[model samples]
Target: MNAFLQEVLTPGSIVQLATLASLIASVNFGVVGTYVVARRITYIAAAIAHSVLAGIGFAVFARAHFGWDWCAPVLGAIVAAVISAIIIGYVSLYLREREDTIISVVWAVGMSAGLLFLYYSPGFNGNLESFLVGSILYIAPADLWIMGALGLVVVLLCLFFYNPLMAVCFDEEFARLRGVNVPLYYMLLLILTSLSVVLLVQLAGIVLAIALIVLPAAAGLHATGKLWHAMCLATVLAMIQSTLGIAWSYTVEIPAGPAIILLSAASYLAVFGWKWWQSLRAASSLPIRS
Candidate 1:
């Protein structure tokens, strides 16, 4: 723990980088996550998150076999994420009856495709584990820059489309009636969700990405009724969880991603239980009625 603190205090150390990554990543997690939870599209987000691996795997294969120096995994992730979001959004909008089946297909195919690509790629693919379970402590400065840029884009877009998005989430029919392009906004929401999920995959990896994205926002929702309030609280909770999780992981020598996820899960449960207890108390306090 002391050693970890010293490293963190050092300028440009991996520990510092990890901390910064978590903080920067938290903004998107909070904002986009609020929309995801509000629209009840967490399953879609999860599919997008896993589907990212397909892009990453293809990028790796390209770089290895075809010598495509420009095909970075992050780029592949962005491409795959956007494509998955579009497909999922289309199905949800027009093919409502097959929503679950389509989502399941996307989820499975994405994972399967990524694995097959990796298998054929001629190399040990050392970074696969990092992408799978995350290795924030090993991220470079370039990763930080990309993450920050993506975070900025996502937050700005959310702010610009706040009213339309809120309408879409709460009442799509009403939004359409009011001349707000409901389908466009809905697709926009899913795209933003995909970008956010990519950031989460970088931090927590695919398996744990959904947890970080949903838990904090869920907790915030339980604590507040307003959308903006929920976003703010969720962002703060994400940052706190990231920091504490890093600290705990360093002290105990556990995996940082899982530690962060576990902390988030515990916090959400605690907040949920407290809210439930309060509701029970409020109900019990209501004087004898009828």
Candidate 2:
């Protein structure tokens, strides 16, 4: 712990970047994650996260073969994530019958395609593990700028469409009856979720990205009834989890992503268990009736 603090206190250390990245990423996690949990679209978000590897792989392949140095992996991840979100949204909205099967196919095919592309990309691909599992401590300054910009855009969009999104999330039929363009808002939510997934992927990698997105929001939802309150609490929880995860990972010489996720999962379970106990106590305290 002391060593971790010392590193954090050091002038211009990578730990500083890691801490900042987690804090910035938490905003999207809390905001979009609230919508995802409310709408029960964690599956869709998971599909988008895994599918991002396709874009990343293709970006690497293109950069190697076509000499497109501008197409960075993160850029590819954003493009692929948005496209996956659209496809998944369309299926959920219009092709309701085969939604699960189609989403599953997308998830599997995306991963397969990514592996194939990476295999044929003709390079060392040293950061492949980091891409798959995450390496938050090694993030570049450029990555921080990109993440911050994306996070700002996500927060602003959520603020702008708060009412319609809340309606769509809780009661789509009612929202449609009220002329809210449910489909459009639903798609918009999915896009925002995709962007959030991308940010989480940078911190936790594709394999654990869904956990980071859902756990904090789940804990927040359990802690509060209102949507905005849940968002606020979830963001705070995510920041704390991220900070602790970074510190724990440093102290234990483990990976930051999994460490962070463990803390998030523990917090969620603790909240859930506490809520359950309270419910049981309330039930026990109820007046007996014949």
Candidate 3:
């Protein structure tokens, strides 16, 4: 453990990068994930995550074809995510009947558009593995700084609007009756979800982004009933899983992204098993009705 810390603590090292990425992921997932699970909008988050690929593709194409040095893929991803959230939120609220259909269509078309754009972009010869599966080892200082700012924004928003968000998530009708803007809050939730998806994509890549968002939050919910308690627990759990996954990956020489996701899954299962055992013990302690 000491050696691991020493290696990871070095400035600008891959281990440092992984650590920063995981920390940012923990913040984003911990806060936004709680709302996601509460509102049961994991599918919407997934749709936004995939749709971000379109933005990345466009950014890449623009940079390659037009020599736009300012076209950062992450910036493009944020724009795409926000736009996708608006479309999904609008449809789900005003056109409830077609919500599912729109999500499905966006999910598919976004990825397809990304792939096509990448194929046609001239003078581009970068591997897509990192974007698809993630490459934490290659994370630069710039990425870490951007992620940090975004993570701070998520934390602040959640803290500032906790009650309204909780009301919206647990009971939209109640929230509406209480004079909270239901539609606005709902859109805010989706927009936050979009940002969280973008952050997770950096940590776990497009393919496994949802796992980072959902698994830790699921474990938190299983362990606790209170929303705030669950959110705090989920954040801690995500940090643990991410750190452990990076350590295990270093030991075994495996990809960090998959390792982190698999570890998160394992942690969730462990929590579930413990919860089940507790229930069984409680049931066993009860007197037989017969």
Candidate 4:
């Protein structure tokens, strides 16, 4: 046990660092997943996750270095992501007429901005590559701590504002009628969504954060009807995938990012298939009356 603890003590070791990341990722997914099912807006998560790259690029370019400090990338990413969120939310609300058009532009522009920054940085041809395909095994202890702290904040907020957030995410009109600050909650959700992107980018990178955020949540959500319970189950599922995926990656010598995603995909498919089989069995068991 002492030896095991020592192994995890290092930020570079696969066991210790990845374990922290797995927990951080699980909690992050649980919070984001709640809105995902409530709003039925899976696409929004994907869109924002991709578009966040633009904001991160701005942060990176301003600093002119990736490894200087985690704070730099995080601040830059948050600014870009929140601005993008506002643009996406504003267009979807007021311009409801051409919302899709506006959203597409938001996503495209963010990604393009990142690409341009990558071009300007010397010997940075792989900046885009790093964001797209993360190396899970390379996660730093400081980054894990950052993600864990962010996860705690998100979880606490969700606990305090559960009813308000649910009211807004699931039904804005009802929330407003109940004297809730519906718009405020909506804005808060989007801002936090971007923040989640920042925390996750550190673990799964920009490319895989969406998968980590949405996949396990979707799987558990689709299989269950209860909101809070679904979130719990999703957290467990995500944790399992993250831990197993890391172990598999270490053993197989594959990239941790892809490994985790592939495991998540497999878990989703397995649960989906099992659910479908149960439905079929239940349907067949209902006897027809002549």
Candidate 5:
């Protein structure tokens, strides 16, 4: 700490704090990833990430024309994500199968359209690479506040809807019979999930966001059977990864976002292997009937 104070704090104290504030966005993403996996909404996460480009591009256009940063992206992202979710819902309902395949089509088509539109709009592709790959250390404080608020909202709502969600994930038919309003629950879930993608991808970039969300939840799930336990473990794992990734990124030459996610993934794989071995050994110990 003293050494860093002696050396790399050149932009003055405020600038350093401001610079560090950028990383809060990534932290928010890490926390959000848990619920995403818990609900088995990874593809939805991916789709939302892809769809954000159109939202961002449209937002940028709005910003240029009207100069309101927050409102534009909020409206655009909600529109894009809701439309995708609704389409995915209806298509799946009618086809009664292949939801993932249908969602993928939506994801691909949305991104292609976004890219094409961006190609035509001036500066539409500006730093688009960062959105796809993530450059979290560049997130501004204003952006951090926004991301933090969104994360809080999502997590809070998850807590409120915890029971129904658990039922929905475990057995939707049972939940529906129990008067869980499965479709409405899912609608709310998708909305929050889409919002999460927007915020997380903003930090880790869309590409890295998947790792941050999935690896921790998967690892946590391996660690425990209970949903709350899994959620807690995933959050802790995310925080560990986020803090370590930031530290390592500063210490090494690698980008912070991917570095953290890769580290989390490696950790998850090690634990997963251990869990599998444990399960196998336990199964082997069981007596066989003659």
Candidate 6:
């Protein structure tokens, strides 16, 4: 265990990359995740994440055929996530009818299209596996830089617009009455959420990234009363899970994303069980309301 820690904590190793990636992801998750849970928009995050695969697949295909040096898969993912966010946001925020159906369609089409693109991308689509299931253990330095920049942006946005965001999350009608630009802020939240999902693609992949963003926040919110407090707790929990997952991955020689997600799942269940037990005890202790 000590040796594993040393290797991962080394200045620049795969384990170190995973650690850094987790930190970056935790920050974004903490901020955007708060809004996601508060607004009851966890589905939006899942949609953006799953839809991002289409962008990645397109980027890979474009690079192969058109040699668009700038069309990195990550870039494609961001574009796709943002676009999908806009569409989904518009539907949920305005259309309001059949929103779930639309989102479900987007989720399926995006993934299906992505797979088709990957099928034809030139030689060795093995790299695509990382986008599917995450490859934090093999994260590139460039990706880390992207994660850092995005993390900073998420923090700054949250700090600057905290109240407005909270207003929108808690009650859109009330926020609108208060001149909070509900529609604009709503879209902004979705965009930010998409960015969070994109950063997580390398950490947890399209299929499982939602867990990293949603689970920690869910646990934190269940334990805290304030949004900021929940966000902080969520960040800490995410760090713990990511670190433990990476270490365990090293020991068991398994995929880091799955390992991390499994730990998160276990923690969530524990928290859930504790909460249930506490509620039961409280009910038993309460005066019988004959």
lDDT of each: 0.91, 0.92, 0.89, 0.75, 0.69, 0.88
Candidate 1 per-residue C-alpha lDDT over 169-194 given as tens digits, one digit per residue, 9 for 90 to 100: 99999999999999999999999999
Question: In lDDT terms, which candidate is top?
Answer: 2
Winner on TM-score between 4 and 6 is: 6
Pull out the clashing pairs in model 3: none
Stretch of 10 with least lDDT, candidate 2: 122-131
lDDT string, candidate 5, 1-290, tens digits: 34334323655343243234434443444445556677677877787778776765676666655666565554566577767867766665457678888788888877777666556556454667876777666655566566668777877887889888778778888998898888887777777777777666665776776667678788888888887877777777776676666666766657767887788888899889999899999999999999
Give one digit per residue, the lDDT tens place, for model 2 in 18-81: 9999999999999999889988989999999999999999999998899899999899999999
Q: Lowest-scoring 10 consecutive residues by lDDT in candidate 1?
A: 123-132
TM-score of each: 0.96, 0.96, 0.96, 0.88, 0.82, 0.95
Question: What range of 10 consecutive residues in model 6 has the weakest lDDT sum?
Answer: 121-130
* Candidate 5 or 1, higher TM-score: 1
Q: Which pairs clash inside model 6?
A: none
Residue pairs clashing, model 2: none
TM-score of 6: 0.95
Q: What's the residue-level lDDT of 18 in candidate 2?
A: 93
Error of 2 at 186 (Å): 0.8
| Cα distance off (Å), candidate 3, residue 281 | 0.8
The full ranking of all candidates by lDDT, starting with the best, is: 2, 1, 3, 6, 4, 5
